[model samples]
Target: MFALMQSTRTQSLHLTVDAATGLKAVIAIHSDRVGPALGGCRYLAYPDDESAMIDAIRLAQGMSYKAALAGLPLGGGKAVIIRNPHVENRAALFEAFGRFIESLEGRYITAIDSGTSTVDMDCIALSTQHVTSTTAAGDPSPHTAMGVFAGIRATSMARLGSDNLEGLRVAVQGLGNVGYALAEQLHAAGAELLVSDYDSGRVQLAMEQFGAHPVASEALISTPCDIFAPCGLGSILNCQSVNQLRCAAVAGSANNQLTNLQAADQLEARGILYAPDYIINSGGLIYVALKHRGEDLGTITAHLARIPLRLTEVFAHAQAEKRSPARVAESLAERLVYQKGV
Candidate 1:
């Protein structure tokens, strides 16, 4: 564990054990180079503790990059609670987890993440004043979707020479909150959607509400389309999927989209544009971070509007340097962070 943390340059890794509630949680704080570390609390049933620790490290590092690219006065951190999805006593467990957060003081602030919700944020707020998503901002999914929508336009504009999404075909590989909302936003922009999800109910809702065409979940990524939006889990762009992908570009809300840096190279070699997931999907983080700081909604909205502009800059830099957008984004973020004192 020590070697793993050292190799990743992780700042801190915390473990919480609550025997009574069967809560086994890990909090990974990657950086506070910019400001207090802020991220989301994820509740997942990992196969083992090693997997959980690795997840925390990867997620925390991703948050650091996401925060840097978004221009927020914050760094990155993440907490994971390992438990069954259908755990019987959620309140007690979360409350205990909240106390653990309190122990960190203001070093880390958490919000709703995968397998968690605004209601869970409320429960977490019970023990620490360090939780967000409990205010009027509510769910950050819509904001994330909005940013992705803007990112797709910018990517399309650069690659295809027009930002208009009208009549464009989009294959959405997930119909979760962010994915469904993104599909709706695209439909409103006059784009055709090929939507899929493991849950038939979500797929039906997307089709009924947005006129999306349903595709089988497993096959959506390989479907031919103008854009492939992966709004679900991470590591989807591995060696196998990269060979199968058939799209002009990929821009979505999922974190850690690349299996590793090599996946970015593979996509670039295929002439596929990739809007770095950390940059494009940072709207939700910006919303929550501003809310945590008690910044006005107008400021948050304005900040969210800059996502596409920054992405455009990233695209421009990538084109000029003849590098992958992911690499360009990381370089841009590193420069910013270092300029502010790495």
Candidate 2:
């Protein structure tokens, strides 16, 4: 665990267990160079404690990069609550988790992430003010999807010589809030949609709503399309999966999409344009950060408009350097978070 932190340059890890509420959580602070670390809190079951710790550390690092490249005056951190199926009271567990967040003072701010919701953030807020995405702060999923939609247009313009999605085949993997919303936008743009998800209901809904053709989850990566959008979990693009992709470009709202840095090289080797996940999917972070600062909806929307510009900059740099956009984005984010190149 210490080795992992050292390799990632993570600043600290905090662990707390509340036997009464059956709360076991890990908060990893990756960096605070620019300002207080801010990220979403994820609550999910894990195979083991080590897995949970690793998730927190990796996610926190991604948040740091996400905030830095988005030009936000903040650093990165993340909290993961190991789900307890036997726990009787969810609110009590989250409230206890909130108190734990409060104990950190102002070093970390929490928001909604996968397996967590605005209601959970509201509960956390009851205990600590260091929470966003509450019932009042609003859900960040739509903004995240909006940003990703713009990014896909920019990516298409970069790789296909046009941003028009009309008649383009787009394979959308995952039917979560963000993925579904993105599909809606793509469908509105007249893109022919190929959809897949573990949930049969979401797939059926997509088919009915967007005239989407359903693809098996296992085969979606290999399905030919103009663009592949992965709005699900992380580590989807690894050695084996990257070899199976049949798309011209990959873009979506999933963080840490590449299992390892080498996957980016593999995509470039295959002529698949890759939009760094953290850079393309940063709309949620931008929304929550600005909203937390009391910015209105108009200001937040304007900030989201910059997602494509940043992605275009990364693409240009990658082309000039003859490297993958993932590598270039990491270098750029590192310079900002660590102040390495000013």
Candidate 3:
């Protein structure tokens, strides 16, 4: 479809199962230039088939860069189940997906993502051994949070020229595992937290745990904060939200935070330091890659620590070249990909 083409440069494959009334799956293998594709399986209720397809393809492409930027051996791929997981016949449908993945012959790898959890990945592991999970060793959410924390610190140092987070107001727009952990890290660093989530339970928990002030999800964009961390979903930073942001820096774990490439430029024009989503959020991919290679934990920690250094380079390149941060980050990734080819 044209929409899918516009969203990503990956090959799209569809899988269906008859056991359920109607089950559909889309897998976007963005690139295998570095290696076989590796990414997460996210389940969501898409607006339509076309939207689902576009999201899958774009997410897959982002995964490729996320892996490459983190120096992972794997390429990028993403899978999306096009139905609500809470509906009827969820487990059977996921198992069916496992078989579909098995048929790929190791060309694509599946892990956990937004809608999918480590437990769901475990379910998929039932039918195929190709599956990789963050929880097989331990929870990856905290590790991801730690990486974002480091990235936020690095971005703050580069943009606002500050390292101490004490009393810095940060608006965390998601309360999922990663967001909650992020909130904890910001709190531990003495940052003042203003949090929001569609899930009342998550918001309540955050308020009780960290003394966070709760705000409506949509209103979070205009909140007064030194930093705005979007850990919820992609495309939250768009034309509309850019003008509303009061934060000095934007950094979070969500991939493809910009709805489109132009949104990155818009952020730069607005005087808000925008950290490329893929560059800042590659920590989860880094952790998974290290685990996949059977590497040591110390190595993983050390690699993650290098995120700040890498981001510092990106920030410097953006400033020296007077180019959008996203463009500079993409150039770095393309350079790596080219070097690999040579």
lDDT of each residue in 155-252, candidate 1, tens digit only: 99988889999999999988888998899999999999998889999999988899899999888989999999999989999878988999999988
**lDDT (0-100) at residue 150 of candidate 3?**
96
The lDDT for every candidate, in the order shown, is 0.88, 0.93, 0.83
* Candidate 3 C-alpha lDDT tens digits along 1-342: 755654455655555555563458888787776688888888888888878877888888788777878877778888988875456766667777888899888878887788877777777777787677735755567778889999999988987789789889999999898999999999989999999999999999988989999999989999889999999998898888898999899999887899876888888887888888888887787877677778889999999998888889999989988888888988888677557751
Q: Report the lDDT of model 2 for residue 149.
A: 96
Per-candidate TM-score against the hidden true structure: 0.97, 0.98, 0.94
Following a full C-alpha superposition, what root-mean-square deviation does model 1 have from the true structure?
A: 1.3
Q: Identify the superior model by lDDT, candidate 1 or candidate 3.
A: 1
Query: Which tens-of-lDDT digit does each residue in 89-206 have in candidate 2?
Result: 9999999999999999988999999999999998898899999999999999999999999999999999999999999999999999899999999999999999999999999999
Candidate 1 yields a Cα-based lDDT of: 0.88
Better of 1 and 2 by lDDT: 2
| Best model per TM-score | 2
Candidate 3 scores a C-alpha RMSD against the true structure in Å of: 1.9
What candidate 3 gets wrong by more than 4 Å, as runs, is: 2-7, 338-342
The Cα RMSD of model 2 versus the native structure comes to 1.2
Worst 10 residues of 1 by lDDT: 333-342
- Model 2 regions lying over 4 Å from their true place: 340-342
